[model samples]
Target chain A: MKRNAAAFGAGALFAVGLALSGMTRPAKVVGFLDLAGDWDASLAFVMMGAIAVHFVAYRVVLRRPAPLFDVRFHLPTRKDIDLRLVLGAALFGVGWGLGGYCPGPGLVSAAAGSLGAIVFVVGLTAGMLIEQAVARALPRRE
Target chain B: MHDFTPIPALIGGAIIGLAASLLLLTHGKVAGISGLYGSLLRQGTSDRAFRLWFIAGLAAMGMLVRLTWPAAFASAWSASLPVTLLAGLIVGFGTQLGNGCTSGHGVCGLSRLSVRSLVATLTFMGTGFATVFVVRHLLGGAR
Candidate 1:
């Protein structure tokens, strides 16, 4: 129960941050994307600040043997560059440039009752479902 | 135009950073939206409750903020639903294929100094640049 509460609290705080940061506003995102127009550099600062905090945070967490939740830090071990990574990045970029909302903000915006957000979430879930189906149908390579 | 100063951007960024850090400290989980959502689909009854509550809290936070600061809601880019849906599908597929989203790889994964994340981030970012180039410049979808 406590863990659940903690998760919910974290999610709520994340949502508030997204709203306060103007991430919920698609125009701001589009402006940032618009290199030729009056560009908005706010997202860059947001990314920088986020990176700075994470740098320090990880240093501290790494000092500890394990995390508070009793699990090893679930960092990815794979290092190879492959088609899946490149293709995924391309698709994400195309979607973001066109819609001006990524998954995090899209989910939060949908919660805020934005019709665009709702559509985005639906499509996102459908995509996930399709991926799962394809993965299931494919023969195991290992 | 959206009026904002460097101060708010910095402050907002810091707050987001702090929140993300705290989440990591407490739950030992990166604030990755895709992983969080994916967990809900894969995990069983024991997991469903927490994920559901977490997602619900995200929605409630938006409502609370909307009630407190109505001005933030004002924006001109209420795009058509179909466009948004298509965009979402692409992002979903991309994240699944890439193994992370912006928050996951861009913020958290990069912080860990993961080379794969670095490559993924660059790819996503570069693709974003190209996409805007095609959409607004070549395609001429101004504003």
Candidate 2:
């Protein structure tokens, strides 16, 4: 229960941040990306602020031998610059430019009952499910 | 730069960072939305509870925003239905295939100074800029 509570609290804070940053709106996001046109540089500030804080805070948190609730950190250890990563990111970028909604803000916007956000989430879920199904059906290389 | 709001963006971003920090300090977890959301779709996972609660909290905050700040929720992107649907589908597939999205790779992964995330972030941003340019400038914007 406590762990869940912590998760909930963190999620709430994150959502609030997104909202306050004006990132909950697709227009703002797309505007940020539209550098050639009338670009909105607010999102850059958002990224800078987040990176600055997390950059400092992560080191502070890691100094502790263990987290309060877990035995070890669950960090990603992959260091590959493979084709899949590039292709996936390129696809994601197109989607982001097309819809102006990433996973976090998409869910948040969907919660707010935006029709566009709903459509985006549906497509996103379908894509994820399809990938899972295909991966399951295929043979493993490793 | 008519709507270039730096202060609020910075504040909100700091809050997001704080949230990420809290999750790490307490749960030893990365607050990547796609990773958390993806796990919920899977079955027989003991860690499902936290993810569910986290998502629920995100939704609840949206509700709160809707009730309090409706203008903040307003959007400017007015693409057609088919276009929006396709975009969503592509985004979903891309994030999953890549194993992360803006939050996972852009925020959390980059902060950890992961080389893979750096490449992913750059690739996505480059493509995003190009797509927007093509859609808005070359194609004369969305309908």
Candidate 3:
């Protein structure tokens, strides 16, 4: 129960940050990506801020033997860079550039009652289901 | 162009990082939204309660912000129906295959100082720039 509560609070705070930082706005996201045109470099600041805080926090928290709630820190273990990784990232980039909505913003905007966001999220769900199916066929990774 | 909000961007981003830190210190989990959502759909994903509660919280916050600060979502992007759907599909499929998105790779993965995350980030950013170039410059549509 405590863990669940923590998760909830974290998600809520994350949404607040995303919205406040203008990440919820697709136009701002694309504008940052638009290098040729009058580029808005605000997204860089977002990243810089996020990374700066996280870099220190991650190290400090990791120094503890374990987390407060869990016995072990559950983290992704795979380290190899393969075709799947590169191809998948490149494909994701195309979609992000075209729509300017990654998973977080897409879900948030959809819940915020944007019609276009709803459409995009529906497509995103379908795509995820499709990827799940494909992943099953390929060698599954942890 | 929207006014450059460096202050809000930096502060909001710090909040995001703080949230991630809290989750990590408390639960020992990386706060990757894509990974959280994607794993929920799997057949036997353990730790189901956390994922559900987290996503529910995200949606709840969104609804709350809608009532309070509508302008945050004011500039919702809308393209042709087909294009919008296709873009969503690609993003979904790609993130799942890649095993992370901005939050996962950009925020958490990068924080760990992982080389894999770095490469993935550059790859996606590169293609993002290229795709935007094609759409805005070549195709004459990016608005």
Candidate 4:
């Protein structure tokens, strides 16, 4: 219960940051990407601020032997660089550039009930289902 | 330059970082939206409870933001249906395929100084910039 509570609060806080930062707006995202055009450099500041705070917070939290509820931290430990990582990120980049909605803002926008955002989410889930099928065929790495 | 908004961007980013920190401190879970949302479609997962609650909270706040700040979604992107759908499908597939997205790889992963996250971040950011350049400059602006 406590863990779920924390997760809920964190998720809400995450939304607050996204909205306040104007990340929920995709045009800002596209503007940030348009280097040759009138570039909106706000995304850089968002990243810089997020990283600066998380840099300190991450180290401080890991000081504990275990997380508050979990027995251990479930950090990603994979070190191998395979074809999947690069290709996947590239594909995601294309999608992001085209749509201006990554997972976080995509979901939020969808929840706010825009037909386009909803359609994007539908396509996204279908894509996930397809990827799941493909992944199942490959040998498990982790 | 005129579009530069360092104030809200920084303040909002710090909030996001704090939220990520809260999730990590309590649940040891990386605050990646793709992973959290993907977990819904996943099976044999014991941690599904928190993921659902997380998304629920996100949705609730989404509506709240709409109420409190209507202007946030006012200038929403108006991509064609095909483009929006294609983007969605590709994003979902790619994030799952890559094992992370902006929040996972961009925020949490980088904070940990993981070399792999660094590589993934660069790959996505590079392609993102390239795609935008082609669409806006060569093809005459996507939206």
User: lDDT tens digits, residues A1-142, model 4?
Assistant: 8888888899999988888887888788888888888889999888888889998999999999999999999999899888899999899999988888888888887887756778889988998888988888887776
Once fitted onto the true fold, the runs of candidate 1 whose alpha carbons sit more than 4 angstroms away are A140-142, B1-5, B43-49
- What DockQ results do all the predictions give, each relative to the true complex? 0.66, 0.83, 0.78, 0.81
Task: List pairs with backbone clashes in candidate 4.
Answer: none
lDDT by residue for model 1 (A1-142), tens: 7767777887787777677777788877777776776777787777777788887887887787766664665556788878887888778888888788888788887777777778888988877666656666886464
The candidate maximizing DockQ is 2
lDDT score at residue B84, model 3, on the 0-100 scale = 75
lDDT of 2 by residue, A76-124 (tens): 8888777778888899999999888888888998899888888888888
Backbone clashes per model, in order?
Answer: 0, 0, 0, 0
lDDT tens per residue, model 4, B33-52: 88889868877767898999
Pairs in clash, predicted candidate 2: none
Place model 1 in a CAPRI quality band.
medium
The segments of candidate 3 whose C-alpha lies over 4 angstroms from its true place after superposition are A140-142
Tens digits of per-residue lDDT, candidate 2, B1-143, equal 89889999999998888888988998888898988887787566567888898899999998899899987779767667778788888887787778888888888988999988989999999999999999999999955
Per-model TM against the reference: 0.91, 0.97, 0.96, 0.96
- RMSD to native for every prediction? 2.3, 1.2, 1.6, 1.4
lDDT of 1 at B133: 79
Q: Model 3 over residues B1-143: C-alpha lDDT tens digits?
A: 45678999999899889988988998899988878888898889998998888888888899999999999887744566677799899988998888888888999999999877888899899999998899989989844
> Residue A11 lDDT in model 1?
78
